[model samples]
Target: MTTVHGSSYRFIWFGLEMVSLFIHFTCLLPLLIGTPVTRAFMPRLNGATFLGPSNALSPVNVAHSRNRGIFCMRSNEMITVEGVSVVLLAGGVGKRMKADRPKQFIELLGKPVLLHSLEIFSTLPGVNRIVIVLDKSYRQEFSFLQEEDPRIVFADPGKERQDSVFNGFSQTLPDASVVCIHDSARPLVSQSAVLASLRDGSVHGAAVLGVPMKATVKESADGEFVLRTMNRSRLWEIQTPQVIKPDILSEAFALVTEKGLEVTDDVSMVEQVGRPVKLTMGEYTNIKLTTPEDIGVAEGFLRERAEGKL
Candidate 1:
C-alpha cells in the first residue's frame, strides 16, 4: 500500500514539472519571433523632428514609430497627476489667537492645527507634495516636529500670503502640474471640496472654493450709517485650496511682482492678468480660525470626525 502511494506522488510531481516547462516555452516564443520582425521593420529615427515617425511612413519608419509609440504609451500610462502639491500659508503673527505661538502651531486634540491641515493633504492619495509656508522666526519651532516623509517640504513665509505662496511655488517640484494653496488656519477643509477644486482647476485654468452669502451683506461708512446693500446672491465667501496650473501661477506671481500689487490670494494675482478664476462650491464648515471662538468650533469638528460622526 505504501509503495503504491509513493509511486502516485512521484508521477504527480513529474506532471507538474512538465506543465511548468510547457508554460515557460510558450511565453518565450512570442519574444523570440517578435524581436527579429520588429528589428527588421523599425529603423532608429533622429530626435530633432517635432513630428513622430508616424508622419513619415516608410515600412522601416512605420515599424520604428510603432515600437517607439508602444514604449511612449507605456510611459505615459505610468505617469499620473493625481493629487496636487499643496502650499499651506501659515505665517501670520496670530494677533487674533493672542497666543505666543502662531495660531497654526496651537494644539488641537494633542496635535498642532497646522499639523492637522498637513495630515489631511498627506493622507490624500493624489497629494504628492506639501509645502508649509511658516514664519521665519518660527523656523526652529517648525523644524523640531518634522516628519521623515519625503512629500513634506518647508518654506519660509513671506511678509504676506501672496509672498508666502511665491516662496512655496519656488520650492514646488518641477514636475508638478498643479498647485493648491490653502490657508493653514482653515483646518476643516473637506477632501471632497479639495477634489472638486482640483477638477474645476484642471478644466478651467484656475479655481477657488467659496460659499454663497447666507446673510444680507451691507457696506457702511460709519458705525450707524449703511451706505449700500449688496446683492447676496452674487456674493460668495472665499475659502482655501485654491488651485491653478503651475505655469499660470508662476505668470500671475510675476505679474504681481511687476505691477507691485498687494493681493491676498493667487486668484487675485491671476485676475490681474485678465484670467477668470472659476469657483467650486465650498463647505460652510471650512472656516478660517482667526479668533478664539473658532478654536472651539474646530475642536468640535475634529472630535466629530474622530468619532465617525462626519
Candidate 2:
C-alpha cells in the first residue's frame, strides 16, 4: 500500500468536486437555455398537416392547409401553465387603410382600436406581461396604458411584421413560458379565443386562432385565370392571437433568421421548423381592420356585443 500526502488527497477531492459540478450543469443546461424538450415527445410531420377544429377538443375530423402542419390531441386533456406574455403587434403604417393615422390608432367605439385588444389582455388572467410593438411616435399617445397597468410595456417596431414580432418577444418577461401574439387591428378578438389559443399553445407548443372559411376559396396561378378550387370544409381563415411556447418560438425564429425566411405570421415561424400548430377555432367577427370600411363594421360588432346580440 502506498501512503498519499495531504496535497494528493486534497487534489483528488477537488477533482471529484469538479466532476460533480460538471454532471450537475450538464443536466441543468437544457432548462437554463430554454431547450424545447417537448420537441422530442411531440409528434412529427410525416408529409401531412394535422388540424384541430376550434370547437372540438378531441380528434374528430381532419383539416388541411398549404402553410403548415397541425396535431390533434390524443385526449381531451388540457395542460395549463402560468406566466403568459402577450406580444401585441401594432407596428403597421396601414398604407392600404389610407387613414390619417395608423388603423390601430383609429377610433373604434370611444377609444383607439389598439385599446380594445390591450384592455382584453390587461384584464386577462395568467397574462403576466404585455409587450406592445408600437412606433416611438405613438408611444406618448398610449402612455396612459403603462401607467394603468404595470404589466404593459412598449417595444419599438421593426421593418417587417416578423421583425416587429421579434422585437416585442424580446421584451417578454424572463419567466414567461408561453407567448400570445395578437394583432392590434383585430380588436374584437374574444377572450375565449385568447384563452383557447393560450391553452392549446401550452399543450401543443403552437396554436393559431382562426375561423372556418365560409366563402369558396379559389386559387389563381395567373392574375386572370382560376387554377384550382380549394375544399372549403378543409380550409380555415387564419387569424391572430397566435400563441406559442417561448422556447419553441425562439427556436423557430432563430432558424428563420439563420435561413433568411420570410413569414407573415408567428405560427409560420414555428411551421418552418416542421412543428405542428393547433388551429383553435376563432370567430368571423375577429376581422382584421384593413380598409376604411372595416372601422364601421367593427363598431357595429362592438355595439351588438354591448347589447348582447352577438
Candidate 3:
C-alpha cells in the first residue's frame, strides 16, 4: 500500500483546493476525467464541451445530464477511515409484483429479499452500521433480523420512499462520514460496486451505481406511436447502493423538501441542486425485484454466482 507522508498532507490538500476552485470557475475537466476506473469507459471529450461554455450548470438539466454519465471525480487517498453507514430501503409498495407482502419480504432462494440485501452489506469491511427501513406491518412478522449483529438496526417506513430513506439517514451511526443508500429489492449489488461508490462519493460528494444501456430507446407522446428514436450512447440504467457524504445528503434532501420536488433516487437529489455526482459501473445482474418475472431472473443470477459462472 502507498503511504502519504505527513509533510505532504498539506500539499495534497492545497492541490485539491486549487483544483476544486479552478473547476468551479473555469472547467470541470478534473471531474470529467475522474478516477482510473471511470477513465476505462468515459470518452475523452473536453469537460467544457460536455457542460457547454457556461460556467454554471442549469439546475433542471444537470441531473438529467449527470444521469446520462457526465459526472466523475477522483477521490483522495490519505483520509482516515471513518466507517460507513448504510441506509437500506425495503419499504416498497410492491404493487407490480402482486405479492401477499412487499416484494422485499417475499421469499427468494428460501430467504426474504430484504435479508439477501442485508447480507451483501455485511460482507464489506468498511461497513459499520446498517439502518434498514421496513414495512411497518411486515416488521411485526419477520424473523430476518432475529440473529442480530451489533451493526444491525431497523427504522420505521414512511408514506413515500424518500421519507423512509431520510428516516434511515437520521439513524446513521454518529461517527459515520460516508452514508450509503440502497434499495432492498436489489439484492445483488456487488461488493466491488459498493466500494467504488464509497471512494468516488468521498471526492464527488455523491456517487451512484448504474449500467450502460444496451438496447435502443424510443420516445412516444402517447402509448402507441413512436415520436423518435432516442440516443442510447448517453443513457444508462441506474441502480443502487448510492454512497454519499452526510452533509451533501442533508443539503440535497433539504433542497428537495423546500422546493417540494419529487425525486426518484438519492443521487438525483444531489444532481437537482446543480452539484456533481459520480457514477460507478454496476453489473446487470444487480437487478431490482419489481415484477414476478424479475424473481426468476434473480434466481438465475444467484445460481450463476453460486456456480462461479457470474
Identify the candidate with maximal TM-score: 2
Q: For candidate 3, lDDT tens digit of each residue in 211-232?
A: 8899999999997999999899
Clashing pairs in 2: 50-70, 54-281
Cα lDDT of candidate 1 equals: 0.74
lDDT against the true structure, per candidate, is: 0.74, 0.82, 0.75
- Candidate 3 global CA lDDT score: 0.75
**Which ranges in model 1 have alpha carbons more than 4 Å from their true place?**
1-83, 144-147, 222-224
* Number of the candidate with higher TM-score, 1 or 2: 2
Ordered by lDDT, highest first, the candidates read 2, 3, 1
Tens-digit lDDT string for candidate 2 (1-310): 9999999999999999999999887767767777544332333344433333335542133322223222233344423346889999999999999999999999987899998989888876577899999999989988988898898999999999999999999999987878999999999988766766776788889999888889998999887999999999999899989988989988998999999999988899999999999998788899999999998999999999999998
The runs of at least 3 residues in candidate 2 whose Cα sits more than 4 Å from the true structure, single-residue gaps closed, are 1-78
lDDT of 1 by residue, 112-176 (tens): 89888877777666666788887667767767545567777789887777888889988887877
Summing lDDT over every window of 10 consecutive residues in candidate 3, give the lowest-scoring window: 55-64
